[model samples]
Target: MEIVGSRRKNSSFSSADDAAVVSTIPLYRSAPELEVRLDDFELYAIHRLRVLKGISDGLSRGKKPNEMENLTKELWKVNMRNSEASEVANKDIISHYVLRLVYCREEELRKWFLSMETTLFRYRFQLETTDAQRALLKEFDLPYKAVSNAEYESVKEKLNQVVRSIGQPLSSADTIYYKVPFEQVPDLVATRRVFIFKGYAYVAMNQVVSLLMTQYRSHLSKALVLTNRKWTSMILEQEKDRLTPIVEALSTSYLGPDYSQPREYGEISLKDIDQVAKSSFPLCMRHLFEKLREDHHLKHGGRMQLGLFLKGVGLKLDDALAFWKAEFSRKVGAERFDKEYAYGIRHNYGKEGKRTDYTPYSCQKIISSTPGVGDHHGCPYRHFSEENLRAALDKMGVGNRAVQDVMDKVRNRHYQLACTLTFEAIHGASCDAGINHPNQYYNDSKNILESRVRATRMVDTLMYAEV
Candidate 1:
C-alpha cells in the first residue's frame, strides 16, 4: 500500500515552522520538564522486534541440527514472553506493546499471531454491519457507537481525507469517512488504535473518529480496509534478507518510514544543529533538550521531540512558531508549513498518532515540577505519591481542601481527577471522571514527588493565562 502524503514533499529545516516543528520552539530545548524516559520500556522491545521470527517461518526453516535445541528453548521463551505481554494476569495492563509491535509493520498477518499473546487488549474492525449507522458496538463490554459498510471503496476515500487534513485547525464536530478490510470484523480488540471502518479505519479518538466513520461508511463501500499490523504470516515469508519493520520515526525528526523529509537547523543540517551554534532560543527550551539527551537520556533525534517538548512546556502555538524562525538563518513558508510543521502540530495537539498532545501539565500534571532529574517522565496520576503530589497541587494554586481531597484520591490511584485538576488548572476544561480510573502502573517513591516540581511551573502559566 502507498504511504499517505508521500507524493507531495517540502521541508523548512532551513526555514522550520514553529507552529509545527519542535526544533524551532523555545524553552523546549533547555531545562525542560516531562522527559519521557522510554528507554527501559524501549529496551525490552528491541529483542522481540529484531530477533524473533514468526513461528511459521521458524518451523519452515527446519533449524540446523545444532541450532534446533536452542531454537526450541527460544520458542518456549517466546511463548512465555507473549504470555507476559498479553495475559500477564493484571487485567488493567492490556496492550502494553501490541500496537508497538504492529507499528513495525503495516500488515495484518503478523498481528494475528501477536493477537494471541493477549486477549484483554484485543481489537478488531468491521466494514459493513447489518444494523443502522448509529448502532452501538461492544467495546470492553462498554457501549460505543459503531457503523459498518459492506462496500469498501466508499469508506477508504473518507478516511484518506481525514489523515490528509493533518495539522489544520480542528473542531470537536468535524465529520470523517474511510474504507477498510472485511477481515477486520473478527480482529476488533481493545489494543488496536488505528483501524478501518467501512471505508476508513482509524483510532484517532473514541468519540470523534467514530462519528466520522458513521457518517461516511455508507458512502464508500468500495475501498480496501488497511491494517498497519507489525507481523503477519505472509509478511514473515518475505522477512528473509529484508529489514524487520520497526517504526523508525517515532517522532518527525527521526529517520522513520513515515517521515523522511530532510530538515535544516540554523542554516545547517538538523543533525548538526547543536547547542554551541544557535543560542538564540529561550534558555529553558535549549537547556531542556540538552538535559534530556545528556542527563535523562531522552533522545531528540526527531523534530517532534523539541516541538512536542515545548508544547509540553506551555508555549502557545503562535509563540512557538515565532521562536523557531528567529533561531534559524533561512526563510520558510507554506510548502515547509504543509509537510513538516503540520506533522508536528498533529502530534502535539492530540489530533494524530497516540494523542501525545496533552500539555503534560497544562495544569493537569500532578507533579511538583513538570519533570527533571531523578524523576522519570511517567504519568503524573500514577507516578506521584499522595503526600508530595498533594503538596505540588497546593503549590499550583489548588485550594487547601482540594489539595487534600486530590491527594487522597491520587494515593488511592484516582488518576482521573489528579489528571483532570492538572488539566483544569492549565487548560481550564474538564470531563465526567474525577481522580478515579484504573492504573496498571503502581508506584510509591520520591521519584513521583520529584517530578511535581514542574507542576509548580505549570501553575505559573495558569496564573498568567487567566490574568
Candidate 2:
C-alpha cells in the first residue's frame, strides 16, 4: 500500500520493517497491544477518542431519554454548546456533557487535515475516471504526495473548497471541517451563543442543518456512491427501501463524493454480501437472540428467526420497526407498536437499545448475507470467535495480520481491524475500503464512528458535571 504523509516516512528505517513504505506507518500491534504512529495517526486517534469520551460522559449523567438522544445526536457535530444553534431544540429537557480528548498535537491535526484533501478533492474534479481510479485517488488516505509550499497551498485551497463548502462553522470548539451527507452547507459553521472556539465561525443554529445544508448535501447524501450517478429509484430498483441515508450521502457536493471509496461496483454484489454474511451471520443471530432473552426478559422463537432475519436485511430501528409494524399490523394491529415499535426502537437506536441490546442490523450486511440470515438485518461477524474468524479468513484467504506493521493500525484506531478482515474474507483480496464496519471496518472506518461515540461520552461526562 502506498501511504502518504508524515515525518517518520519522510525519513528512512531498517530493511526488516514491515509495510514500511514510510517508517511511521500508523498501525495497531495486536500481539503486544501497542499502537504505532509516524504522525497524524497519533493525533487523529487522540482527537477522535477525546471526542467520544466527551459524548459518552454526557450520556452517563442520567438525562431523560429524549434529551439524552438529542444530546447524543449533537455528538455528530463538535458542538458550539449553543442550544439556539441546534437543529432540534431539547424541548424535553436540558443537559450538559463533558469529556477529555488527548492527542499528538496541532501539527498532526494540520497534517491529517491537509492529507484529507487528496481524498476529498479527488471527486471535485469532473474527470472520466473509473470508480476504482476514483477510489484509488479520492479516498482520504492522508499525507498525500509531498509538494513545495506553493503547491501545498494550492492543494489546501482546493481543500478549502470543502471547508468553505460548509462556508460556516458552528461556534468553534476547535473548528472542525468535514464533508457530510448534507449538500447545502456552504462553508458552514455554528456555535453556542456563549462558548466559541477561536479561528472558527459563529454560525446561526439554523445554518447547521438547515434546508440548505440538507439540500446541497442531500443530493450528495443521496448520490449513488462509487459513481457520480445519483442513487435514484431508477437504479436501486427493487431495493429502494434499503437505500436509506447512506445512499443519500452520495450527492453532497462538499462531501458527497468520497474519492477514497472504490466505485459502487454497482449495488454491492450478492456474492460478496453472502460471502461476508456467511462468516458473520450465525454469530450475530445467536447474540441477538440472547440479548432479547436476557436483557428485555422476553422470549419468542421468532426472536431468533425473525430478529436475525430482519437484522440480516439491514433494517435500522426506525426502518426496522416500520418494516415490523407494517408486517405486525398486517397480522396483529397497530397496538403491536406499543409492544413492538417501542421495544424495537428501544432495542435499535435508543440508549435503552444500546445499553442492553448490543447487536443491531446495518445496511451493508443485509445486502450481503444470505443462506445463513439472508436479507434479515444484523451484524454477523462479532459473535464469531477469533477462532471462527480465523477459519473464515483463512478460507477466504484474507485473514493475515502482520506484526507491528498492521497491528499498530488497528490498535491506534488508524484502521478498522475487524471490518477490514471481514471485507478481505469475502472478496478474497486486499480490502482497503477504510470505512469501518462495526465488526469489519478499517482505517477511516473508525474515525467518524469513534469520534461520535467519544463526543457523546464527552457530553455525557460534562452534563454529569464530571470534568
Candidate 3:
C-alpha cells in the first residue's frame, strides 16, 4: 500500500532523521517458519480480538462515545489486573495476523475481516494518548499522519484555495488536518466534505476515522471479489485446520447483551398471553401475536419466532404447550395439533428432539432474516417497505411525525434505531438506550410503562393526602 499523507522526502531530511522515520513504521514481516503452530492461548486471542472488534463496531454504530470509552478503559484495566500483560500487548498485532491467514482466500471473508480490523483500529486509536498514538502509528505502519504546524502553514494557501473552490467556509484554526490520498477518500470528495488539492485530500481530524473506515471497507470489498475469482479453495483447504477455528470463532462469538434472563413480564399464563402481547410485546411480536389470534395458526417460521419470544417472556413449558394447543385446536382439532404442531412447540422449549435451549431471536437475526409471503417472522422495520411499515405504524396509533422519523431512519439503513424510535412512539417515552434484542425492547417497554404508572400513583396518593 502507498503511504498517502506527509510525503517522506529523503533529500530534505538528514540520514539519521530518515532512519528514525523508517524505524517508526513497522513492516508486515513474515513469521518464522518454525513459529507456525498456534497454542490454545493463541486461539483464545482470536476470540478476544473478536470481542474487542464487536465493542468497536457497536461504538461506531450509534453508541454514546463516553459510554463506549469507559467500557473500553474498563476492559483494559480488567486485562491488566489479571496480569495478562503479553495478551494485552500482543492482541492488536497477533489478531490481524490470525485473521489474515483465515480470510486470505475468500472475498467475503476478507471484506468482513477488514471491516472488523478497521473498527478495531479506530477504537484503539481513540483510546490512546498523544505519545501512545504516535507509538500505534509506528506499530501499525499506518499511512496517514498528523500535519505539523510548519506543514499546515505551507499547505494553508492550497487548502484555502480548494475550500473556496468547493464553496465551503475556511476551517477554524483549531481544526486539525491530515493529508490523505484523494483516491482513498472518495466519499469525502463525493460529499464535498474535504479540501482537496493536487492528489491529496486535506481532511479534518474529526473526519479521519470515517474516511479511513470507508477506504478500508471499499478496498477490502474489491480485494475480496478479485481474490474470489483467482484464489482456489484447494489452496485455502491446505491451511483449513488453522483457518477453520478462526472462521468458526467469528461466526459463533457474541459479546452483546444477554437476553436469557426472564426479567420482563414474569410467569405469563396461557390466559394472560393476549394482555401481555398487547401491553408489552414489541411491534414485531405484537404483529405475530395478532396474526396468530386472528388465524388460530401460524407458519413454522412465525411459530419459531413467536414461540421463543413467549418462552423468553417467562411462559412456562406447560403453559406454552397449552397455549399452542388451544390456538391450533380451534382450526385443526386437538388430534392434529398434538400430531403436527405440538412436537415443534415442545422442541422450541427444549423438550423434544435435540433438546437445545433455543433463545429468542435477536434484533440482528430478525432484521437480517428475509420472511416469505405468508410468514410474519422477521423484523417489520427491515422486511416491510416504507409505505407498508408506515401504514402498520399508523394502525398502532403512531403519529405521522413519529412515522416520518422512523421512515428516515429506515431509509438511512438504521433498522435498530428505527425499532428504538418505534418503541419510543408506542410507549410515549424516551427509550434512552440501544435496543439490540426483541426481548430487550419488550423489557424496556414494560419497565418504562411500570415506572410511569408508579409515578402517577404517587401523585394521586399525594393529592388524596392533601385533600
Better of 1 and 3 by lDDT: 3
lDDT scores of the candidates, listed in order: 0.34, 0.33, 0.66
Question: Which ranking of candidates, highest TM-score first?
Answer: 3, 1, 2
The residue-level lDDT of candidate 3 at 342 comes to: 86
**Candidate structures ordered by lDDT, highest first:** 3, 1, 2
Error of 1 at 261 (Å): 16
Which digits, one per residue and each the tens of the lDDT, describe model 3 over residues 1-467? 22222333421112343334322112224432333346633554555554554464454246675666666656545432324654443544454455555555544446446655565545555765544443433444455444456676677777777677767677566545667778777767887777676787777654565554665566555555554443354535664676555554554333455555476467777777787787778889999999888999999989988888888889888888888888899999999998998889889878889887777877755665667888988888878877788888898778999999889888866777887888888888876666777888778877888899999999999999999
- Among the numbered candidates, top lDDT falls to 3
Query: Each prediction's Cα RMSD?
Result: 26.1, 25.6, 6.2
Task: Provide the lowest-lDDT 10-residue window in model 3.
Answer: 5-14
Q: Report the C-alpha lDDT of model 1 over 358-408, residue by residue, as the tens digit.
A: 332211112212344454443444555566566555544567765665566
**What's the C-alpha lDDT at position 392 in model 2?**
41
| 54 Cα displacement, candidate 2 (Å) | 12
Candidates 2 and 3, the one with greater TM-score: 3
Could you give candidate 2's per-residue lDDT for residues 1-467 as a string of tens digits? Answer: 11111222331111232232221111111112223232322333333333333333332222353554455445434432335544122211111100001111123322232222222222222222233322322232423233223322323344434445555442222221222222223344332221123333222222222322233233332221322232232434543554332232221112112222223121223334334344333333434433443343233433434443444344445554554455456555788656755574445333463464334222232212332322222333433434654554455445465323333333433323444444544444564433223333322323344566799999999989964
- Per-model TM-score, in order, reads 0.25, 0.23, 0.70
Please identify which of the two predictions, 2 or 3, would achieve the higher lDDT against the true structure. Answer: 3
State the lDDT at 102 in candidate 3.
53
